[model samples]
Target: MSEVYAARRTRLREYCNAGGSAAALVSRPANVRYLAGAAPHGAVLLLGKTEDILVCGPSADRPSQERPDEALRVQTLPGAAGGDPAVAAADLAQGQGADSLAVEEHHLTVARHRALGSVAPRLRLAGLGGAVEQLRVVKDEEEISCMRIGAEIADQALGELLESILVGRTERHLALELERRLVDHGADGPAFPTSVATGPNAGRPGHRPTDRRVEEGDFLSVCLGATYRGYRCEIGRTFVIGTAPADWQIELYDLVFAAQRAGRESLVPGAACRDVDRAARQVLDSAGYTEGLTALTGHGVGLEIDEDPQLSPAAMGKLDACVPVTVEPGVHLPGRGGVRIDDTLVVRPEADGGPELLTITTKELLAL
Candidate 1:
């Protein structure tokens, strides 16, 4: 809604004013979308002291589904020759008499930042930092609703995959099929690259799928998420390939499950982000499997798959209500393959409920 974008921009403008900037140029796609309601390719949002404008380059097809907020003016860069929208936005900000314009240094390239300066030397360029991302960490109900739907789609895809034959399928095929199922279940697409790790690759975080085929007695781990209406949620599970799991397999699965549950249970308002990681990491460390543990037990997820409030030992932040994060702690034992259980959940007040689980897929170590 236009009102939603307006409110978000108002908040961002307040942040800019607090930082002594008269205007802000949002060039990052996610930040632009968060503030302007839509970010077409090469689109940049200018939150000015007087007028908020969405600048776009020439495009054959505008994303009609993601219309810019009616309250904001949309300006296309002039002429048949395409130009950088951020540069044009800076010029517009200068025209509006904005003395200083804050920009996301992390998102903008050195060349692009220099281009903005070239266009409007009078407008002081200040670093916007991660202000927009910080604002996005705590989501509204509407954003959480999209993530909930995405989690459901991911669970449905994973459930369907379990019912299918997996005796000899390649990891790449499995990953692709899961992604297709995500779309079939009404997802815009997979939130991130679908990971299907088999055998020794199981429990390896961010492992790219390869030609390894599923085989009996191998541990299979799948990490996937779905994007629903621009919101994302992740779910990961590890399963044994045979009708029964070996003793070592059972032990490893149970240990990882406990660690994941500990991390999930720690998703309460006011909990320190690192303490949550400690809750999960300690489980593996005590079990003598600390060497190959993932750097973070979990991370915040929303418009971006991995955003703010990182659940790592070195992280510094507190979880707040409506913050959606994934507790994905895993251990990889090199040649033996290991376990990883992950779920996306929204932190809520204890009176209403504890963390709300979006991904309902069973954590039981399923033996396929």
Candidate 2:
């Protein structure tokens, strides 16, 4: 793992050198963690001409699991100025005689950017422009293994929820229970907020859990993920509450299942990201259920719940092998509930047995 982090930093250093910057400041927490093994609170990474350093604020606590790679030097700042490690990192880079430093413009606020410039008046500031994010698009086998474990944890959590009584349970109650289960099943934590939508709220992406209780024949949609070893994987499944699903419920579920399958099947290496989205979207579109569709069919997932190589109609780029992404597609009628089926899968070559599925929970519209 230390060698992996060192190699990642080496790649970033080469990128910075090619861009004419001798130093690079990584302020984004995720990017910092990608380069340094862990991202302490208020910590930043400085790839200086002399040496790479993980700069920590006074308040930052280096947990055993969150420690930076031993290959990188750690510098702790003192007092009020420690609140912003990027400024201290910039100052250190200037002292290291770096002529120019590249920083993540997207992650820095105007005030923070100004403070960095103020701290290193002589150093030329350049935009890193998602360079670190680009490097993170593809997953190494170790990273994929982490996500796979996370997916299994999520699957166990969801499977347990399905076995227990669900009727009369409020959406908020179910969501909270699922999160607790994720932790109980050995997850670092819930990857994101567990979403439990009941009745009319079902199938809505990013729906906040409400007080609505599960009722007979209501479409119960749930979206959840678990974070294991800093890697995240998502899984969503829709079920029918109480009684047998109505004809409309089965239709909607089948439609969404087909669409999700299409999206998953399109995840081969070298396939266009937009095309993957289209494959899923066209199914819903052809069914005359085009209106109110989500802006994206699916998106990449990893250290962050959402990452790169977004599977969207407007997304650019080709799918790369080992890139894990979700294929979630759904439909919801105005006052009536709908269905959603989502799964996390890793893109792979044809000879590699196609995309590798991480989440194994059944997508069948089970009645609870």
Candidate 3:
């Protein structure tokens, strides 16, 4: 497993050499894990030209192999307990004859950047800039496997909810129950906050779980996901309460469902990020519910819940194969309610079956 990390480091070293940097310091937790296999809390990775090192905080003694940190050279030489690992990584890079070091400016605070400069006066500091993030956009089979498992865990949790008596349950309680089920099914935790909006609160994007009890003739929308091995995926479903649904509720659910399908169908390799978002946004816009639309129709999922290639109007770049992203388009009408359908999928070419859906939870609106 360390060999896997060694190979990853070798590739990054090649990238650094090509970019004219002697070495690079990876301080972002996800990037550090990608390069070194394990990133202790507050640890930083120094990808020297020859040897790679994981510098841990002074007080950190326990290290786990969730992703296998043991594959890289470990250094528990933090200058002080809870001290900045980035500075120590910069010092190590300087000692290794690295004249120039690249750092993640977006992830590093200004104070830490200044400390690195002050600690290593001779070394030139450069921006690593989105290099690691770019590498992460197209995941390997191993990464997709983690996301697949996470999606399965989330589906199981949602499936169990369908069997229970949902009417009269508080939104907050249902959300918490789903999160607990995710953990019981072997997930690291919820990918994001579990959203359970009942009655008038339903269908809202990012709706915080409210205290409202489920009422008959109301829409119940739920969105949730689980994180496994640092990989995350999302799933959402909107349901009708009671034996029969109202005409307005059916119309809103169908519109949102179509928007979600459009977004999912647009998940092809080489599709523009904004174009995919537009595929869904247009449906809701023409329906006169465009006033409170969320900024993004969907976004990326991986080591972090929200990553690059944002499915928004202002986003740039085209989608690529092996990229795991979510397509969630939703609509929420104040005082009335709304509907949201979401799923995690991987962008694939037509030869390999267009887009591979990860979250397989039923999308058909069910009456509960």
Candidate 4:
């Protein structure tokens, strides 16, 4: 793991060198964790010419579970409280004789950026852009294993919820229970908020759980994920409450299921991101259900639930093998509700059995 973190930093250093910067400062928590193996609160990674350093705030202690790589130097800024680690890292870079520094312009604020320059006036600052994010798009086997474990935890949590009594429970209560189950099953936490929507609220993407109680003949939708070892994975499923699904419910579920399947099938190496979105979206669009559809059919997931390679009509990029992404598509009718089917999958070559499905919860529309 130390070697892995060291190798990642070396790659970032090479990118900075190619861009003519002597060092790089990573302030984004996710990016910091990617390079340093852990991101303390208000911490930054300084990939200096002399040595890579994990700069921390005065009160930023390393998490018990996520320790910094032994190969990297850890430094706490000299202060009692409240100082930007990014500024301190820049000062350190200048002290190390780094002529120029590359910073994540997208993640830094204007005020913070100015403070970095103020602290290191002689050191040139360049935009690192999304270099680290680009580097993280494809997962190594270890990273994938973390996500796979996270997916399993999520599946277990959701599976347990399904086995319990769901009727008469409020959406919020069910959501809370699901989160608790995730932690009980060895998850660091829920990757994102557990969404449990009942009745008309069902199938709305990112719908926050409400106090509405589940009842017979209602559409119950749930979307959840688990974070294991900093990696995240998501899964969503819709079920009919206490009765066989009606004709309309069956039709909508099947349509959404087909759309999700198409998106999943299109996740191959070299496939365009937009094409994958179209593969799913077109199914809904052809059914005249495009009005309330979400902008994206799916997106990549990793250290963050929502990462790069967005599966949207306007997204520009090509899928690569080992990139894990979600294929979630749905249509929410204003008052009638809708259906959503989502799964986390890893893109792989056909010779490797195509896209690897990580979230293995049943996609079959069940009457719960």
Against the unseen true structure, what C-alpha lDDT does each candidate score? 0.92, 0.93, 0.88, 0.94
lDDT of 2 at 86: 89
Tens digits of per-residue lDDT for model 2, 1-368: 79999999999999999999999999998899999999998899999999999999988875445668999999888866546788889999999999999999999999999999998999999999999999999999999999999999999999999999998999999999999999999998999999999999999889999999999989999999999888999999999987688999998899999999999998898999999999999999999998999988999999899999788889999999999999999998988978889899999998999999999998877988
Per-candidate TM-score against the hidden true structure: 0.98, 0.98, 0.95, 0.98
Worst 10 residues of 3 by lDDT: 60-69
Writing each residue's lDDT as its tens digit, candidate 3 over 1-368 gives: 67767777778778888888989999888888777776667888898866788888876543343654565778886354556778888988898989899899999999999999999998999888888888888888999999999999999999999899988889999999999999999998999999999888998888899889998988999999998987889998999999988988888889999888999999999999999999999988988778888999999889888888799999999999999998998888889988888899999999998999999988887889
lDDT of 4 by residue, 25-76 (tens): 9999999999999999899999998988999998887557899999889998
Clash totals in order: 0, 0, 2, 0
Residue 221 error, candidate 4, Å: 0.7
Best by lDDT: 4
The C-alpha RMSD in Å for every predicted model, in order, reads: 1.1, 1.0, 1.7, 0.9
Error of 2 at 9 (Å): 0.5
Shift of residue 200 alpha carbon in model 3, Å: 2.0
lDDT for 5 in candidate 1 is: 86
| TM match of model 1 to true structure | 0.98
Can you write out model 1's per-residue Cα lDDT over 1-368, one digit (the tens) per residue?
Answer: 78888899889899999999999999889888888878888899999878888998888244455777888888887668788999988998999999999999999999999999999999999999999999999999999998999999999999999999998999999999999999999998899999999999998999999999999999999999998888899999999999899999999999999999998888889999999999999999998986867778899999899999899999998999999999999989888788889999999989878999999999988999
What TM value does model 4 have? 0.98
Clashing pairs in 4: none
